[model samples]
Target chain A: MATNLTGKTIVITGATSGIGLATAEELTRRGAHVIGVGRSVGRCRAAEERLAALNPAARPAFCTADLALQSEVRRLAGEIRGLLAARGPAALDGLVNNAGTFTYWLALTTEGFETQWAVNYLAPFLLTHELLPLLAAAPTARIVTVSSESHAHTSLRWADIQLRRRYNGLLAYQQTKLADILFTAELNRRLRGQAPHVHAFAADPGLVDTPIGQKGTPELVQWVWQRRRDAGIPPAKAAQGIIALLDEGLAPRPDTVYWRHGQPRQPSRQAQDAAAAQRLWALSEQMCGTNNGSLS
Target chain B: MKSYVLITGATGGLGKAFAVECASRGWPLYLTDLRPEPLELLAGALHRTYGVPVRWRACDLTDAGQRTALCEALRSEQARFGGLINVAGGDHEGLFCEQTSAQLRSIVRLNIEATIEMTHALLRLRDASETFRIVNVASLAAFYPMPYKATYAASKRFLLDFSLALRQELAGQGVTVTALCPAGLPTTPACIAAIEAQGVMGQLTTQNTGAAAAGTLDAALAGKAVYIPGLLNRLLRALGGLVPPTVVAWFIGRRWGAARRDLGNPAESSILVPEASPA
Candidate 1:
């Protein structure tokens, strides 16, 4: 555990399990007060017990919000803001946008966005926007969006970003990862000069052995994932890179915000394409209307 | 004095929808429920969102003394009622012998006693200048004898029969009584889970709280006595009425038993439908 974590408060979505959970545990172990979030109360309660058992003095708490809905995301942001304000400073040191999904079939959330697109991409976008005031209040803050190397395989489908016209589960997932990197780049570019202390970075938690593959997939896909995951590293190892990005004191280079192996790395050509990043931001803003007046 | 539609259970899923629906229709509202905080929150939000005159207080409708206190507060304010939506009812779903005596008593007290007492109290306070409209939320399960939900079904049956009988008495007296016998309402989290546990059938029969509230109001204001929301739910009710109640009980027993297993809280699970001003 690091000695520099005292008095810091972090928020981690999907912190109930997998990489997010590991990151939350690591952060708590270092003496930071963590607010872990899960999709359901039962899951959050279970996660709370596990964290309490590991670090009783950590005094961690969990909140439940369904990330698939933008309404829920906005509400969660407001809730965290209220909670932080009541505590005193109303500042946020870190936000881990790690909650995600992988579904074999195309399903739409109540708001009509594709489930994967809604959970993986839109949630992070809206949540970050909603929490900008709190993030801005911190002397220095970090936003780590968990992207994947799979982002290299695909570019944004501008015609149908939600994939209503054509759908493949793996491809859809890869596209969200691509969108995440693009979003990080766009956000970093926007933050320069205005709020240079609040850096945005994408952490590639490379193929950790977790249950991301088996859920909502066909039996054959599950069988294949079971074999493939046997060779992958544990979530703790993957979580370290994300933690490093969050803990890094210095500001990152604006153009290179993607992190891997605790070092800055360049994303795919499409991810780094400023034109595409701007386009994606505009579309996302249109889809989920911007609540905050400032969105450069 | 201006008349405000008095809604019980103003914080629960269905009750909130009723509050929103009434406010959307420009009806001044007097909302009551168990908790002062949530009641205050919802009332403030409704007044802000819909720009309607929304007044609220906390009252445990099941307690006669509390109900009397609530009426007295209304009386002191010179509150007149042109509408009353009785949405404050609850259920404890499990085997009759398994549920605690207190739980069983709560189902009867809340679903029957509280509703009847509120109805009588509000009838006297109705605004004589405008026609009064009343909607009593019953369940489609009222038509059958359910095995697991024997007590709940019987209570809803009472509301259904009581509403119809009251309608006959109030006919041509510038007041209309409506029985809202909905099959399943996707109002609260627990109810949504229960509906999902039933698979495709649950998905089909269940109605959204906002839409149901709006449509039920439309039907009630048009003087429709019995308004069951969905065509399929109404079909199920009509078809269910043809079968002997004994057979219906066995079928519902098997169906709910399966849903309970899917729910996976085996020791003893109680669900609250969350309507009415049981604050």
Candidate 2:
């Protein structure tokens, strides 16, 4: 049966480019009303135009917010919640927590957390928690987080959580990706028992030639991948993998990792580790400046 | 209205199983492999048993020219390939140091390069009208780094990552890409020998070709981007939390190292351990 995406409202972060933009386009084309969250007004406007061009019948709303900043991420959630609340209960269908940062150089967000962990993991953590009411309003809501293959190598450092002691851009990225996996796993665990209507999933784009990889003045990894574009899969295909999980009929599996090719790859061991996931969840709550009660 | 299915690595044990299963499903077949005799026999057996159309091509997928030629042949035959099962891939059982430049190139060429080329070609030909599906045979080794099978693990990692990205990119395009990551499937002679030699026959589950392919195909259609063939594999994959890859690699390498010694090759020798990410 064809998925009934009509009348479904989906909010996608990082919808300005690559997988996020492609997913927005695909979802709109499938007849869903998309509300795009991008950092820049210009980029958001451009995305709005693209959405209009792709599916003129589906006029997607655009909101500008720097996802790396907690205040902005919070405001975006409030704005989305307000928008959905205005439309009555069960207005939104999904939220694609796709916006993320890959800092090549060691940097910290204004919140004092590592930039990658803050943007890729914590922002979504706080944003989703804050918008739980709006998500719950919907009959069936899906939260899709775009993670990375780098997570396979990540080992969560409890003492030096931010990698402040010893830092490498790739390593930090991997840790955050691991955090995303752990976050999704815990999210699903909580959702399965408490919120059956809400389903959580994680998707990775593989080794796409994205700007996130072209970090630190493009000298580091550009040559490695530029030489291998033909070998690497495209971003458009990766977006489809994310959407498959959002499909209405997609089976609800906790701790599932969706690959770009539409199959559920096994997540890194940390993702499926319930004890680790719980610890990570607790840590994430602390990092996001939220109390344990918020998620509970 | 005949439906045609494509199988790469049709000569291998697992690939042959997919061929047999698809033929049993009453689909006409387009099979490719490096060896001619096995490919011919697999096709003949399928044709004789299922009474379905079967086309066999012996082409080294590592060679781009040969892969392209095979794809062109399938296209020219007016075969609207419904599904593509990339089964033609294997590991060179050696340490990273033992792998010659040529051997490393062959591993990359056969496992990663062939998969990317074939999938890209099929993606170009696919549309919503066709029930398009892609199944890339990756290894659980793709999950993490293995000291013994470094290149093979990296290649599988590349496939797993690519499969995740491609699945999302092709959504609504009506094509599904599946990466099958299985560990220690005692389907072939090589696998059985390796299991016994390692005494991991206790730890490993010997899944035959038919069962593995069935699981692969079923998961692929269900839009599963990565499918580990067995329940134990799935459980271990989820164990990523408690264990780290470094630790797993250390333990696995030690065990395989001992096994290699029993095989008359000491710890100094090469062992092809398919990398499974720490879980």
Candidate 3:
């Protein structure tokens, strides 16, 4: 069924490449206004051009920010808010927390958090918190956070959440992915029953062929990702699951749901735990210094 | 043939030290790490200082695909490694139950899986006629059954045993495996804090990262099977061998327990302290 989204505006992070870029293309093609966020100016401009090419009538917008840095994330949010305000109230229809990185080693951001944790988990957490007002202004808004099946590999490490004591690239990636699901669950819980209610969901795109592991990876690591990419679906196919969540006509589902291949599936027990979700929410707020009343 | 000495975790404290030491010796180098910016900076500095060819790639070694791609890339570049330094290893310090499954998995993947895979791949890429030196960074923890650092200690033990076995197996092929088992080295600020948390023992056993790197390479080139850096660390390893595994674990657990207490319960604090409610 072709869903008409002519009046809606959505923001997507990491929108210049992989599934993120694909999702922006799909949404814009469906007549929705896409505010694509990317790191590099050149890439963002290119992505904007591609989206415009996809739908000449609804030209997609682009914003540049390094989502890895909290300050950059805050600035990006302000820019998004400004755009939303310029379009009048109720402009934001959806938000897609899609930017992520798999650091091969433990690297820290300027903010002193692990790079994977900061970029994958905290960036989205902070961005969502910052943009909640714009989302709330809409009659109905949705949040789709891209998580992974790798969440099952690890639960939250409260003690060394930043992985300061021990650091492993894969483990850090898993921890951040798990955080995404937990964050989605808690956000849904908090926003429940509110006017213009917000629906938060976590999506597992599965392994798709992307530039994520193509560079800056060990030979063996690259080979493994390549094999997975060979067997995995393309980014366009994976974007379907995200697009499904953003479909307003789709039947109302649970406030917090994990979507896999465009279907709702059970996430890990830890991901579904309300208490853990709450804890993660609070911790995320603290880590991001977003403990202000804005995210209550 | 353009020969290079490849170092994993090359941007890290001990890894960086090893890079500098190798550069001092005028060895053409190839460094790999997760961070490209620092690796590039290090490579450029080394090249300028030593006038040797320095190359680097940012790679996540835990991913099997990246590892394969790295091998292919090196092969395509016609790169031959005369030495392989597996200096990348990490530990999540806490009770095993308190640690996340991800942390446990990382300890094994980076320390054991990545090490083994890198060695296997590089062994195929090394010059057959040349004497190849391999340095695997183990730890004094490898000699003990540590409680709080269970996974890390176990992974180091794997490296130590594997290095010894491989050393003997590859002796005929002119390859030497040197397992560097040093106690606390104040490599990073976190490591320095960890050492301080152990009180007197950590202070007494701690070795300078530069010295440790220098000593390990020197011993590896000398065909030593194992290199323990500090005298105090060597004595402790020997003493640890004299004690029963249970007894050693008990003592180490007590020490780590203190460290954990001093570090405080970061998990509890974050969860309990509520954020300001949304207006």
Candidate 4:
């Protein structure tokens, strides 16, 4: 059954390119009002224009922001709020935290966190926290963060969550992916009692060929990616797995919130560690300086 | 028709100095920053201390809506502004590739975008009868191509060139624009720390913020196009002109890169950007 998302507004970060862009196209094709975010102004404008042209019915608006910065994320929430407010008190129905990055060399946001940590893990955490009110305002809302199967093996170092000392590009990326599922599970747990209608989910976008791996990488990494990309699936296929989480007909399992290819899968033991999720959540609160010990 | 000089980034080190200097001279002020409580405290202190008419409202200048709301508030009040000081600016010190694109965009937004938009808006809001003095807080690095501070320096250079060009464009229309280029002044704790990290070089170039504010204001009032505060800074600017920009960039890259490493985590303290004035 092809359900209509005619009046629903969904906000997706990093919608200008790669899986984010492909997901945006899928959302638009479904007749949803998409509010997309990108870092570069030119790219945002271009993406908005392209999306508009592709689907005349899809009124996709793009906001330019650097999700790596907390201040920018706060501003983005306000901008999205203002955008939705302008459209007759219509609350946001969905939030897709699909923006992820893989940097070979370590970089830092203005907020002094590792770039991958900031963009991949922290951006989603902060953006969701900031936009939770809007999510609650809806009849029912869903929060879908794009996690990875890379989350399976890796574990977060509680001592140095950011890996400030012995930084490895792959390790840092994997740690953030781990943090994503943990964050999603913890956020879902918190929202269950309070705003039960607003559910949280994690999508394991299985190794789609995207430019995320190619950008700002070492020459060796680029050489490997050139060959590795052939084995990966298309971004549109991965996008379906993400969008499936937002489907109303798709009944969720009480025990399984992690989905891949539209099917519930048991995450790693580390991802299922309730105590670890609680610890990571508390630590993230401190790092983000977010006073949302409880839902705002 | 009591007119007031509006200062952006009112709670910052140099911004606070500008506010204090203006108040001491009996210039009524309209201040704006990112936080409300601090603005209230500063306004109260300024009014109590200097016995000057001080008013403040907190605004995030980066947001166009907030800026418009602030301007609309001013317009509703029928407030007049005698001078405008663009003191709200931001910087991120690191290698270009090593910094997030968001940091790079922020430098452009705060340094270039906010300044230009505010100037355009406030110029329309200016009291035509009074001489509207415009002071843009550019840096000494504006003259050169910087490396680790590439984005910041480029933004400042944009301000420098823009201020000069705009000054000419608005010359006979009762507005005089001045670009204040200072080397180093202890404007914020982070700034002071960053300077201290430069060792003897920081000490040699650093000056009093109060004096910089005072001198720059005087220079602006006198219709000077540019004001470099310290004598050493002035001399250094002149001497730096002798070297090729490529060489200057390489030298600065090495020096500032080393200094940045010494400073450790740049943002562990507070947000460096001063959420400057709005309306």
Candidate 5:
């Protein structure tokens, strides 16, 4: 775990707290220069200050971006590209698509799409695609997406992807998780064996206690807290799995699915469905407005 | 020549249940699994009970080469394949990092690799104008990352997605691919172990394996991409997803981790594993 990240520049979305913040601290401690992305400037500044205090002034910088909005995510992507261009080629070592929000109530993003799906799926989709050049500029770059096991329940409804007809927050979140795996699989398929080196890996940080769960209510959040406290494994250990994927070169099959505990997890039914992958790819191209090829 | 439904993992708990459901319907059977003795015994019993011809193929499905050879042999036998159900699989109990490479590889090969190969082989044999069915048994664990049974869940998720996509691609091609997502069935060893592992062995009786299989087959034939076996599962599947990944992952990971530890407690085993006769 003691590897030098000294000159390495890392980008992480959702850096305000929980896994994102914890990862920021860990990466900064390991000598990497991290650019923390969060929605609130105050929280971002606070996190940056905390990191500085922990690192004794050797802290990664902070960038404020609301990943829920495509425009904002696009801007963040550009900013990252600019930073890397200035830092020189292969300066960017890793990108963590960790920023996401889930609402018990159905909400819409600035893009007019469902909030959870847009923030969790669409935003990452766009940001990753837009900054691909910067990712490619680097000799070997790693893109670690945080997905979930909840994705098993999600069925891709091509006809009504937004859940406009029948909206359920949980189902929508699962849809996005399923999308994460599909996107990862497609990305790996496109990478064709060149991963972490040429953009490889995505991980699901199996349940850990984090502030993101408290968005609903204090009581609800406490319930979440107690459940996690009762059943929760250490987030640090789960984070180790993400670190493992980044450090230990991904297996021969990056397109193959894995869980945060460093176990090989099955992807959602949709991830393996080639026909659905094809359909989803076409739809995602339309949604993200990019032309990456199909997984078939 | 009578048409036959070939099933893998046909000797175990869920597989045996599926076999009974199919046999009762007068479907000729072609069953395979690693446990040759029990599989053969089940095959003989089913044949005698139903008066339907039964053929048992013994092979480790995780071995791709052996699975290929088995498929070729089945094709050579000119078996009129009507449907193929992939029900054979097992789980490794341990922390993800502690899991041996062989354990992870074996589960992946059996659940994902073997199923994929078997589906392709049988799809190749289906008559152009005749509708054929392929049922890939997946689990509710696939719905999300399992902190405990991580790899097994991910494999099921892959199958769930693969089955749906294949179903769509094969649309109008006379081949239907349906993935069955069953949660907490008490009929098999794996199910019992999973239930015991979760500290909710009593809640394991949500649906019988035979009923779940019939429901899954019905959904597959009707062209539904995925068939979640129970109402409660469908609801939980619908709920508990509104929060962010890190949040849900944290909650689930913690809960499952604790449950895994509980399941590991030898005293809890009595409450977890149900003693049952093979249906």
Candidate 6:
């Protein structure tokens, strides 16, 4: 079932590859204006060329930023605001937080945060907080954060939230994914009953055959990952869960909802905890140094 | 071909216990740590005592390049790992705002990032026909909010969650992930001091490193999702669940806040103490 997204503008991070790229292609094919965000200028340009080739009339755009850095996220947000403003008010229809990384070791971003925590969680957090006004300018808007089923593994560590005591790559990645869900839930709660009808959702695309967990991995691990990728679902198929949230025909669920295969699915108890969600929201705001007005 | 149990942080107190416990089981061992001398000594002792093959690698798990190098070495050796015990973790005890960026980053890298990479690398080496085990060393701190040990507690929380989540993800593949959440272990001088400072609560909750390691491995092999060492620790964890997190934070803040005072460090004390009224 194809849904037409004509006359709507959407921004997707990590739009150069995997599910982000697939979603961009799908949205552009449906006649939506897509501003694809990528890490490298070359990749962004390449993605732009590919999108152009796929749909000549789509006029898809591309932007570049290292989402791991707060300064870069702020800059990218400003660029997006400028682009949307030039197109007049009520331009942005959706924002997708999809850029993420799975590190094989503990690495720090330029801003001094754990790499996975910075890129996968805080980057989207700061970007969304910065772009809320633009989103609110639209008649109806949606924010989608790409989370994972891995969130079920742990609850929030309120004391050592940044993992100052111990570090594990998978655990760090899980923390970021859980943060994505909590962030979405808190955003939904704050935006509910507000004018402009903004909606926030977290989506699990399941394990798609992507280049994730390949960098810095051993050949044997890569081989096993390749096998898993072969058996896993395709990125295009996985991306539909995100696109479904943008569909107006589907009746709206709660403000903060978890979606899988285009249907709402229950997340972990921690992910659903209102108190944790609120606390995480406050902490995220403090860490990112952005208040989105009401949140402060 | 005899399979080995790979253990990280083999130079650490709990890591040593896991090594000894597995050696007693007559299992071949592959041990890694940042310091080569301790790992080599441990490996030689284990080999002589248990008559089992012991391989030692001196590599810093916090470095991406080094981690990749270690993974490549394991692949080239065609090493088959039947079990992986992630026991490498440390904590920077202070208000999160007061800690140096490098100190905080090291904790995250060592505790969370290194464990994930090591597990992924070793999981690739698993023999599909045999059962595989993974025991992650989380802390009972994973269950509560500790203001003074914020990042450390959060990292353990991550481990607890990741272990349970991976358990389900790999259940069909015959791999079991277990999280060991021990309350306290006086493993080092600093740990001993911290435990002593906690007074009665620490006395009641602390467990021996060897017992915790052995129990954790047994529970992991039994396919248990979580293993909290010590009866008191388990009971405290249950009680923790009943209290509101805010209350837990408040209580822990008071406890750790006093410990910091005993250490005579006021720089990190502001997080827990209420501010003084203006004159």
Tens-digit per-residue lDDT, A120-180, candidate 3: 9989898988888888888888899999998989988886675644556678788999999
**lDDT, model 6, position A116:** 87
Give the higher-lDDT candidate: 2 or 4: 4
The lDDT of each candidate is 0.80, 0.73, 0.79, 0.79, 0.69, 0.79
lDDT of 6: 0.79
At residue A251, candidate 2 shows an lDDT of 60
Descending-lDDT candidate ranking: 1, 4, 3, 6, 2, 5
Candidate 4 residue lDDT tens string, B1-279: 147888888777778778867876789999988888767766765675456888888888767788888888887877788888999887765467767777777678778887887788789888888899999999988988977667777888899999999999998999999998888665444565666677766756766565677789889989999999778888889999999999998888788777768877465322445321100
Model 2 stretches astray by more than 4 angstroms: A225-230, A252-260, B1-279
Clashing pairs in 4: B8-B277, B9-B276, B9-B277
Clash pairs detected, candidate 1:
B8-B276, B8-B277, B9-B276, B9-B277, B33-B279, B34-B279, B87-B275, B87-B276, B88-B275, B88-B276
Compared with the true structure, what per-residue lDDT tens digits does model 2 show for residues B100-144? 677788778888888888887776655447668889888878887
Q: Which is superior by TM-score, 3 or 6? A: 3
Interface RMSD (Å) of candidate 1: 10.3
lDDT per residue for candidate 6 within A13-110, as digits (tens), equals 99999999999998888878899999999999999999888877778998899898777898998899888777777458899999989764344443
**Candidate 4: segments with Cα more than 4 A from true spot:** A1-4, A293-296, B1-279
Predicted candidate 4, C-alpha RMSD: 15.5
**Which has the higher TM-score value, candidate number 1 or candidate number 5?**
1
RMSD values, in order shown: 8.8, 25.0, 20.3, 15.5, 22.6, 23.9
Task: Give the per-residue lDDT digits (tens) of candidate 1, residues A114-197.
Answer: 678989999999888888778889988889999999999998887556564456778999999999999988998888856777
Q: Tally clashing residue pairs in candidate 2.
A: 44
Q: Fraction of reference contacts reproduced per prediction?
A: 0.00, 0.00, 0.00, 0.00, 0.00, 0.00
Best by lDDT: 1
Q: Rank the candidates by TM-score, best first.
A: 1, 3, 4, 6, 2, 5
**Model 2, span A104-152: residue lDDT tens:** 4444443334568778888888888877767777888888888878788
Listed for every candidate in order, the interface RMSD values in angstroms are: 10.3, 26.2, 13.3, 15.0, 23.0, 19.1
lDDT per residue, candidate 5, B133-192, as tens digits?
788888776667666666777888799889878888888877888887777665544444
lDDT of 1 at A6: 59
Q: How much DockQ does model 2 earn?
A: 0.01
